[model samples]
Target: MGVCLVLIVLAWNVVRLWSTTAAVVMSVVAAVLPPIAAVVANWGEDH
Candidate 1:
């Protein structure tokens, strides 16, 4: 759900910027951080 929201926002920005470079930067940020946080959160939860 959160990822979807981020994707929508990135899509909106991509429309404005319309550059592959900008999209890649946005995608990298969107792609990387959440999984890291999710793993940490899940590990803490399991303990």
Candidate 2:
């Protein structure tokens, strides 16, 4: 997802310099988002 990619890029480039822990947290959250989006997107689908 676009949001996930943005978070990762920002975490790597910007956040990491400020705090590696925070960047790792952001990356973890970003990693979780796409699967959540997929589940939500298909939540009520017939197939």
Candidate 3:
């Protein structure tokens, strides 16, 4: 849910900016961070 919300905000900014390099960078971060975060956040739970 949080990831979805962040994606929506990033998408809105990307649309608003429409041609900026930062939007591209943010889009990449939005694509990559969630899964990495999920792993890191859960890394010790199983033990």
Best by TM-score: 2
Residue-level lDDT of model 2, residues 1-47, one tens digit each, is: 88999999999999999999999999999999989989999999986
Per-residue lDDT tens digits for candidate 1, residues 1-47, read: 48746764875576437776666666676677778877877886655
Residue 32 of model 2 has an lDDT of: 98
Runs in model 3 with CA error above 4 Å?
1-4, 7-19
Q: Between candidates 2 and 3, which one is better according to TM-score?
A: 2
Which rank order by TM-score, best down to worst?
2, 3, 1
Name the better of 1 and 2 by TM-score. Answer: 2
lDDT of 3 by residue, 1-47 (tens): 47656765876665546755665666677778888888999999989
Ranking the candidates on lDDT from highest down gives 2, 3, 1
Higher-TM-score candidate of 1 and 3: 3
- By summed lDDT, the worst window of 10 consecutive residues in model 2 runs over 38-47
